[model samples]
Target: MKQREYYFDNAKFLLIFFVVFGHFIQSFIKESNSIYALYKVIYTFHMPAFILISGFFAKGIYQQGYIQKYAKKLILPYIIFQLIYSVFYYFLYGKSTFNVEPLNPHWSLWFLISLFFWNMMLLLFAKIKPVFGLVIALLLGLSVGFVDWTTSYLSLTRTFVFFPLFLIGFYMKKEHFIWIRTKKARLTAITTFIIVFIGFYHAPSINYQWLFGSKSYSSLAEDPFQAIFIRLFFYVLSCMMIYCFFACVPNKQYFFTKLGKNTLYVYLLHGFIVRIFRVSDMTDLVNPPKSFILIIAVSFLLTLLLSSSMITSLAQPIIELKITKLQQLQKKWSNLFQGYKAKLFE
Candidate 1:
């Protein structure tokens, strides 16, 4: 069956907005108000939902066939950005770096690794036994949740927990997705919002961590089931929210659509932008004024505008590089498939 793709434009922007806002709030804590409270509430739902959206997108890609196609598209960018930031990190912290590096594995790059592994795993195991694939994912999640990141096992959990969620997003009940894709999407989103908002009351949000603290903290912690339960609610809300946005969004303007296209660029650049702002001591932004409402609004506007502009102007070469690599990967995969047909009988 041909999958019904949902473009839900507004949700894409909303997710991007939350992503920008969440990072800004966390980074500029010196200036923040109790407003951090609201950030925690929003984050509970944001990431899991984003993972699901990727899964939904993956459904289309899977049907098309895995080439070095998705890998080149995903991995080439990962390499470009990792090396770019590796240079950046070396310059910034390598000056007097300690024995154990703060982000040696390259923290931002974790998402790419997790995504690649998840995609590969799905491709290999899913066709033979979907349940087995799910079981493997569950085991991976469990290991990360309970096992230590620094331990002998190199696999990390925190970055990969969303693998299962990513799968769920791609496979949906047509009836349910249709209901969400319909005009009734508003109420669907509203219900999801309500559920996640309620979870905020019980969700375990990190507040006191030191700057650039170990992301391994996400590996595992207390009340695993509760966190998972909360994550479940947030995941639902995230999809509904996405559906609602698409249903209500006006025709795409060149500006916003352009921004969405370069979301990867924005995600990469914003931290540095935030750090530069932090160093400048502008707005006395540290211990910023109590109007979090205004602060968050301005932060979103500024990050989106700056990141998008920088990506278009400065990162064009990398963009071309990504396309070239993707094409090469497609060619390689096509050749492999054509030259080596599946064996007829063992």
Candidate 2:
């Protein structure tokens, strides 16, 4: 019998779990410095890995002209969830969910704005050459360090940070993207990554209070020479580790996979939940071990449960109807703003 393909399950599960685990540790594991250190180590890899895996499966979006399709899939869902989460965040946290902007951009919602630009770039540049497109991704990612993080969202930096990895996923060749056969390259990349990552962890983060400190965001760069090579090196290492982890993973049912499958839902819903629970001092219930473990476990579990219910449980039928309606709305939006060229003309 032919084995069934699992698509990106293992990697997706890892990514979803990391997002929860990283957030929990950042918030709840503060009592232990050792735990905080470990949390930093874990987070160094999460978003990059997620972007790479996203890139790996992106080939289809290149063919059959999935630009419109992608807008619906990623953009619409992003907006839908951002509005929903914003309300929940304020309710939960009892404070503003975002730093005040001149025009007031949502704080965490920058991920959506960044990724939307990324997908658009990929759709445009992937046509030139995959590697060229990857170059564009790097340029976009690096643009972030140059901006004032407080003043506004740096879509360029976010783009540079993630788009290459996304392309790595979208255009990934099973051969080179793997490690078993390319042991030397993978090992070299990983070894360099560890040494450099340690350096970055300790390398002076810019002084935030100084009037000129924000300039450090741009002028200083990732240090030890802030070039494209260093950035690519880390990107490769993250992707390799992800590849190796998935390749060696033992098949087992994991609740996180359910969560990953419904990442859009959690991405949309969880921030508000965090805020709501925080406001109630329910998060204060996370007093050291009990609440620490409780919030971590409950956050992942609840997000998983809610997302699964939306996608698979009795509610999916109703939810699917909603999705269909939204998709139509999405179509209208796509038609209204058809292309960059049209925008210029109008």
Candidate 3:
């Protein structure tokens, strides 16, 4: 078997951590300016970088059964989680009625649907020259904002809005990542991050929703035509931040690096804990400065916990539609029992 690259694995772990951290701090965005700015900064690159990495690994589209493979991987879990989240929200909010709409993904579940669409889209997009294809993707992203109906339903908005990043990743080579890992590049990345954070902090008038790419230009502004330029600006900002993020990611393995392999588990499972926290009285207890520290700690611990073998073992069936982890645990326990039994006999 081919060895996995530590660089990408490290990148995945870090990005997923940011994803968790971003979600946890979202409830407090209105309570603190620092949190709001930080939220905007995180949103600018976290998902886009994640999508780029996914696109980088999507070179296997030509392999047999690729479509079928991702369908089972992405679509199946999306369906399961959609239904589960619906039931979760009904009780969490104490709603008058229960409703489950598979078409409209709930919260972070949009990534799964959008990811699948990105891959399917490669069938056509990949055929065009990379430069032309990217231009087309960008144009579609900008144009989609005009069609008010192109909202989150089916994740259509994001599918187009973010496809350029995905396409860029698809065209990237390992040498490109290697080039960014130089000492000079790393320093520049650090500087870029600081400048971006400070910019967001001072620019409070900028609608953070622009970073989400979920809403239409019409809803975001009275003049929908002008909003297109705003969306274009974000696309540029997100891409710049994404490069800085990639340049700074360490190419070495760490204890948490293995957790990267199970990001899907964290992505799907962390929502339950995050959602419960959001609705509970716990959020009110948090205060600024200190709240930032507390939120980071909670987010880190949550990422670690969800990525643990115990949690993954339990969630594997629903998320991966496989009992492999559970079976491995069972076999491990059986061997341990057999060892003790033989000892007693001896």
Off by over 4 Å in 3: 1-4, 336-346
List the candidates ranked by TM-score, beginning with the highest. 3, 1, 2
Per-prediction TM-score to the true structure, in the order listed: 0.68, 0.67, 0.96
- Please give the CA lDDT of all the candidate structures: 0.54, 0.54, 0.90
- Judging by TM-score against the true structure, name the best candidate: 3
Candidate 1 wrongly placed segments (more than 4 Å): 1-6, 28-34, 60-65, 97-104, 128-136, 150-155, 173-176, 181-188, 191-255, 286-289, 303-310, 319-346
Q: Is candidate 1 or candidate 3 better by TM-score?
A: 3
For candidate 2, which ten residues in a row score worst on lDDT?
A: 206-215
Each prediction's RMSD over C-alphas, in Å, is: 11.6, 12.0, 1.7
Decreasing lDDT order of the candidates = 3, 1, 2
Report how far residue 304 has shifted in candidate 2, in Å.
Answer: 2.9
- Model 3 weakest 10-residue run by lDDT: 1-10
- State which candidate, 1 or 2, has the greater TM-score: 1
In model 3, the Cα lDDT at residue 223 comes to 80
1 or 2, greater by lDDT: 1
Candidate 3 lDDT at 225 equals 79
**Least accurate 10 contiguous residues by lDDT in model 1:** 208-217
**Candidate 1 local accuracy as lDDT?**
0.54
Q: Write the per-residue lDDT of candidate 2 for residues 1-346, one digit (tens) a residue.
A: 1112233564566566656666555565447544444455555566666666666666675556577766666566555555555665555556655433322335455566666666676667777687777666666555544554533444445555666667767776765434443556556655755664465446434121111112324444445235445555555655655555455433445545434566655554455555555456555556755455665677567656656643343333232324553455567667877876697888
